[model samples]
Each structure stands twice: as C-alpha cells, then as structure tokens.
Target: MNQDKRQILAQYEKSMTWVESLADVTEEQWRTPIEVGKWSVAEVIGHLIPWDEFVVSKRIPLLFTEDSLPKAPNVQEMNANAANSSRLQSKEETIGKFLNGRHQLIDALHHLTDEQWQHSFHIGESELTLYRYFSGLVEHDWHHFLQIEKVLK
Candidate 1:
C-alpha cells in the first residue's frame, strides 16, 4: 500500500486501541461533555458507529460505479439517536459497538485496490477520490479524539 493508504489504515487501527483504553476511565470522565452544551465523550464516540457503517454498507458499494450515490442521511436524527444510545449504555458496551463498526470499515477499505483509491467519484455534485473521502473521515476521527482527550484531561 501507498503512504496515504497506510496512514489512513493506521489511524483506524489506532482509533480502536484509543477507544478501548477509555473503558478504564471513570464513568464520570467517560460521560463528561467536552464543552458546555456539547456531546459527552461517550456520545461523541457513539456517533461514529453509524457513520462507519454508512460508509461500509452505503457509500463504498456505489462509489466508482454507474449507480448514483444515495441521498445524505438526516444528520440531526441519527446523531441524537446515537447520543441517546450512548447515554443509556455502559461505557464498555458503547466502546465495543464503536470498535466493531470501525473494524468492519477497516476490513471493507482493505479490499479496495490501489487504483480505486485514486478513482474519482461524484457525491451529489461534489467529486472526490476515495483517498480524499477516507482522509476526511480520518480528520473527523482526530477532531473527536481531541475532544474526548480534552474532557478526559
């Protein structure tokens, strides 16, 4: 694999380890919001599960194909439901779900050929390469990771 793909895959692998470590944190720390009126650490991690599933099941199959990409999901509803689920579940359960979903995404991405990484596809009116798409997701992961880390500290 190229450096870019390696980097993305490494981030995915690193995320699993990072989240697994959160299982050891105190419940109060796990549930603390990163900022006033924002999502708690658990909720922030919880929200990632469905997004990974969406990328694996919905986004990957349609990309680089003749078929049109599906419409975007309702962000508010999906996020609210995920956050609620996180709030109701144990920290271990929430982290387990996140790890499972992320593993599935990593597996799907591993199957893609190097050629596909560079292939451009249109999402609605915007065109982007698979590498770019995954790169954006990695950036999203870092954004949340920082939020959780801040709250933990």
Candidate 2:
C-alpha cells in the first residue's frame, strides 16, 4: 500500500483500539453530552456505525462499477435513530455495534486495489477520489474525537 493508504488503514485500526479503551468509562460519563446541545459520547459513536455500514454495503461495491451509486440515506432520521439507540442501549452494546460496523468497513477497504485508491467516482453529481473520500471521513472522525476528548477532559 502507498503511504496515504497505509495511514488511512492505520487510522481505522487505531480507532478500534481507542474505542475499546473506552470500555472503562463510567456510564454517566458515556451518557453525558459532549456539548451543551450536541450528541453524547455514546450517540457520537453510535452515529458512526450506519455511516460505515453504508460505505461498506452501498458505496464500495459501486465505486469502480458502471452502476450509479445508491442515494444517500435520510440524514436526520438516521442520526436520530442511532442517537436514540445509544440512549437505550448499554455502553458495551453501543461500542460493540460501532466496532462491528467499523470492522466491516475496514475489511472492505483493505480489499480495494491500489489503483482504486486514486480512481474518481460519482456521488450524485460530485466526483471524488477514493483517497479523498476516506480522508474526509477521517477528518469527520477526528472532529468528533476532539469534541468527545474535550468533554472527557
């Protein structure tokens, strides 16, 4: 793998470790909102599951294929549902789901050819390289990680 691809894979792998380390966090801390009116730590983690699942199932397969990509999910409904699920589930369950979805995504990404990393694909009308797309996701992850870290601190 190229350096960039290796970095992305390492980030994804590191995320599993980081989240697993959260197993020791207190229930109250996990449930507390990261900000005044934003998602709690659990909700933030839970929201990631569906997005990863979507990428593994919907995006990856069609990226270099002739088929048009599937339409994006209803963001509001999807996020609300995930947050609600986090609220109702135990911290262990939420983390487990997140790990599962992320594992599936990482496994799928690992199977892509090196050429696919630089290939452009259509998302509706916008075109983005696989590396650029995953890079954006990594940025999104870091944004939430910072929010959670701030609250935890």
Per model, state how many residue pairs clash. 0, 0
Q: Candidate 1: where is the Cα deviation over 4 Å?
A: none
lDDT of 2 at 151: 90
Model 2 scores a TM of: 0.96
TM-scores of the candidates are 0.96, 0.96
> What's the lDDT for residue 103 in model 1?
93
Residue 93, model 2: Cα distance from true site in angstroms: 0.6
Error of 1 at 12 (Å): 0.8
Q: Please, what are the lDDT tens digits per residue for candidate 2 over residues 1-153?
A: 866678889999988888887788899889989989988999999999889999999999989999988898999999999999999999999999989988998899889988888778889878888888898998998889888888988
Candidate 1 local lDDT, 58-140, one digit each (tens): 99988978898898789999999999999999998999999999999999988888888877899988889887888899999
lDDT of each structure?
0.90, 0.89
